[model samples]
Target: MQEFALIMAGILLAGAPLVLATLGETITEKAGVINLSLDGTMLLAAMASFALASATGSAWTGALGGMAVGAAVASVLGLTNIYLGQSQLAVGFILTLLTRDLAYFLGHSYSRQPGPSLGYWGIPGLSETPLLDLLLGRQSPVVSISLAAIALCWWWMYKTNAGMRLRAVGESPRAAFGRGIRVRFSRLMACLAGGALVGLAGAAYSLAVKPGWGRPQGCEGAGWIALAIVIFGGWHPVRAAIGAYFFAALQVSGIYLQDIFPSIPAQVFQVAPFPMMIVTLLAVNLGRVGFVQDLMRRYPFLKRFSGSWPITAPAALGQDFDPKKGL
Candidate 1:
C-alpha cells in the first residue's frame, strides 16, 4: 500500500503541470487564439522560476518571473499574428525556437544547482480517506488549485456572457464584430492569459516536479505533450486535464509493469502516446471527407469528433480591419 501510495504520488506529480498547461491552452484555442509556443513557454518558465528561486530563495517570486516571461513571449506572438497579420503558425513556431534559445543562453549558469520544490497540502477531510489517500488525498495545493481553476474555467467558458462573445469571435470574426465584439483585444488578452497559465505549469515543474534548476530541455517535451493533449481533449479544459492524467497514468503503467513486461522495450511504451495522438487526429479529421465521413458515421465513435482541427485562429477575432474588404 505504501508502494502504491508512492507511485500514485509520482503520477500526480507527473500530471499536475500537464493539467495546468492543457487547461490554459484549451482556453486560448477556444478564444480564437492558438499560442503554439507552449514548449518555449514551459521551457523558459522552468528556467526562470528555478533561477529566481535559487537567487532570491523565494519560489513565489520565481513563479511571478516565470509568468512574466511567458506573457511577454506570448504577447510577441500576439503582435505578430493578431496585429501584423502574419501567419499565426509561422509566428508561434518561430517564437518557440526564439524563446527556447533565449532560455538556453540565459539559464545555463543555474543548470547544475538544486532549487526548492513546492510542498504538498492535501484538502482536510478528503486527504484522510483510506484508498483515496493514495491517489487524490496527498495532492499538492497546486493540484487542487489546478482542478479548481479548470472547473472555474469550464464554468466561465460555458456559462458566462463574456464566453459567448469569445465564442462568437472564434466562430465568425466578422459577424462578431458586426455585433460589436472587441475581437482583437479579446483574443490578445486570452493569449496572454493562456501563456501565463502555461508559465505556471512550468513553475510547477521547476518548483514542484524536479525541484531543481536546469536548462531548456528541463521542460523536456512537456509542451508538445500539452499541445497534443489540447487536440486530444478537443480544446476543453476539463477534458484536457483528464487527458493529462491519462497520459501520466500511461507513463506510470510502464514503470509499474516493468517486470511484467520485461521483454517489451520501455521506450516503445513511452513513444506510444505520440502515435496514438496521430491516429486520433487522422480519425477525427479524415472523417470529414466523403468516403471518410461514410466510414466514420458507420463507426459511430468517429462521429463524436465533428469539429475544427485547426492549429491557429482563422482571423484576428472580430477586428477585421481589412481595408480590402471595406472594413
Candidate 2:
C-alpha cells in the first residue's frame, strides 16, 4: 500500500506539466479559439526557460521567460484570427511548425547544458502528516501550482461573472455580443492567460519534471497529448486534470511493465499510452451516438450521471468573430 501510494504521488508530479498545458488549452477553447500551436509552444518555452535559468540562476525567472514566449505566440495567433479574420486552423498549424523549428535552431547552443532547477519543498507542518504528506505536502512548486490551477480554473469558469462572459463568448459570440459582452476583447485576454499557462507548463518540464533542455526534450509530443486530453476532459478543468493524471499513470506503469517483461521491446511500452488514449477517446465519442442517447432517454436514472458524459465543442470554437459583420 505504501509503495502504491508513492507511485501515485510520482504520477501526479510527473503529470503536472500535462495538467497545466491541458488546462491552458481548455481555457483557450472555452473562449472560442483553438491555439493549436501547443506542441511548438511547449518546445520553445522549455528551451527558453532552460537557457534563461542557466544564465540567470533563478528557476522562477526562467518560468516567467517561458510564459512570455507562450503568450507571444498566442498573441500572434489571436491577432491573425480575431483581428485579421484569418483562419485559426491555418495560422495555428503554421505557428506550430514555425515555433518548433525555431526552438531547434535557437536552442542548439543550450542543448543538455546544466541549469537552475526547481527542487522539491515540503510544506512545514503538512510534511509531518502521514498519507497527506506523501500525496501533497512534499513536492515541487510546479506540482502545487498545477493542482491549484485546476481548482481556480474550475471556480473561475463556473462561479465568476468574468468566467460566464468568457463561456458565453465561446458558446455563441453573436449572441454574447447581443447580450453586452465584448467578444473579441474577452477572447484576446483568454488567449494571453491560457498562453501563459501553457508556457508555464513548458518551464515546469525543463525546470522540474525533466530538469534540463535537449533535443527531443522528452516533451516533444506532450503538447499534442495535452490537446487531446482537453477534449477527453470535455473542456472542464477538473475532468481534464483527471485525464492528465490518468495519462501520467499510464506512463509510470509503462516504466514498471518494462522491468516485468524484459523480453518485450521497450519501445512498445513507451508508445502504448498514445494508442490507448486514442482508443479511450474513440469510446467516449461512441457514447454520444444516437442509440446511446436513446438509451439515456429511456432510462431517466442515467440522467443523474449526465455530468460524466463527454461534452461537445463550443459553437464558435474555430470561427472568427467580426462585430462589423453583425452576426
On lDDT, the leading prediction is 2
Candidate 1: pairs in clash:
none
Per-residue error (Å), model 2, residue 82: 0.3
Tens-place lDDT per residue, model 2, 218-294, is 88999999999999998899999999999999999999999999999999999999999989887777667788779
Q: Estimate each model's TM-score.
A: 0.86, 0.95
Query: What's the residue-level lDDT of 65 in candidate 1?
Result: 83
Tens-digit per-residue lDDT, 2-66, candidate 1:
77877877777788888989987877777777777889888889889888888898888888888
Which regions of candidate 1 fall more than 4 Å away from where they truly are? 1-8, 215-218, 263-266, 280-286, 296-327
What are the Cα lDDT values of the candidates? 0.76, 0.91
Residue 270, candidate 2: C-alpha displacement in angstroms: 0.7
Weakest lDDT window of 10 consecutive positions for candidate 2:
302-311
Tell me model 1's lDDT, rounded to 2 decimals: 0.76
